[model samples]
Target: MSIEVANDANAYLGMKTLDTPNSNNYVEYDGNGHLTIDVGEHDDFDGPDTQPGEGVNSDSFTWFDGMFQLCNQGKAEANISYELPDPPAERDIPGNWTAPGDGYDEQVVGFYYISEGGDDPGEEGDRIFVPEGDSVPLPVGECREMGVRTVTKGVDATTDAPLIDGDVVVTADSPAAGAPNGTDPS
Candidate 1:
């Protein structure tokens, strides 16, 4: 999986991992505040590079990409959006090609805001299994910590928790300080 973070300031941060077989892993966001986390796969290939009927011929291709925004602008909220692969039954399968199941299943993505200097997670400020494409508004206060996690359906919810967890200090915007006007004090 790959992870990228960006904001209005033009600052960018990113992380990625090589695709491993049958391994479940994820990236976390541990930054200051007001950043978006883009998660998905890149350049996934399923068929051989040879001519069709001469080599392996896959019937269909599929992939997923999405972005979740953690904003503290007017109100602390997490805006989530993602483009998931359509159902296999709905896709067009090419003739004279083998269409292997994409193995794409419904999963749950979660986001939360933790209290400053706190270790235990309470019932408050926790958005569990957030809708696939929706925004979750946070409580009325500064969020000092933020976390993200993904889990496959029908699995233990606590397993494979957030691999990325860190502090985040949301700061309100303010006007730039003006240069010292004519008066010289000392």
Candidate 2:
């Protein structure tokens, strides 16, 4: 997970791998929207790709949370958001995005936000939000572990990497603006 800067002038994100390098691999943020939680898979003998990445797991599709330690250095906190943008995307993946029929468990590939080590409250289409400035702990430089359940799944003959139907949105907003929060759109 990447630490977001709500007040860029004051806020900063910082981390170094956890003490256990073997299990907790640390990576510097590279502005690509994440850190320390990259995963991959390849056909055996054909390749594990050009590189055998760190923290190799038996299954390539699931990354259990606890891979992030975001240091909040600003007054505002960062909560993940999953609202689709306005005006829509010009070119989006084409497919039947809804259930093929009743009771069908349609494919799901997304960032499942974790709250207090339990199932995401957002799965029902409503999400939770911390009050203004509650996201960042007091005493600047204080670090908070942000846990996100990264889910990937295979859909019949679709791309080997699941085609993303939504975006992992992170944004900067104000505490008084009543943000770092979400409400049912309807």
**For model 1, how does the per-residue alpha-carbon lDDT over 1-186 read when each residue is reduced to its tens digit?**
765655433322112222332111222233553343433332333336743231111222212222222333322222223332332332222221122235534333344333333343445544333333433333322222334444332322233332113322333321211224312223
lDDT of 1 at 59: 28
**Candidate 2 lDDT:** 0.35
Give candidate 2 regions above 4 Å deviation: 1-28, 31-37, 42-63, 76-107, 112-143, 148-154, 162-168, 177-186
lDDT by residue for model 2 over 42-102, one digit each (tens)? 2232233565443322213443344445454544443323332231233222243322333
Regions of candidate 1 where Cα sits further than 4 Å from its true position: 1-69, 74-122, 125-127, 138-145, 153-186
How high is the lDDT of residue 11 in model 2? Answer: 36
lDDT assessment of candidate 1 = 0.31
Q: Can you list the residue pairs that collide in candidate 2?
A: none
Model 1 per-residue lDDT at 35: 40
- The CA lDDT of each predicted structure is 0.31, 0.35
Which candidate should be chosen as best, given lDDT against the real structure?
2
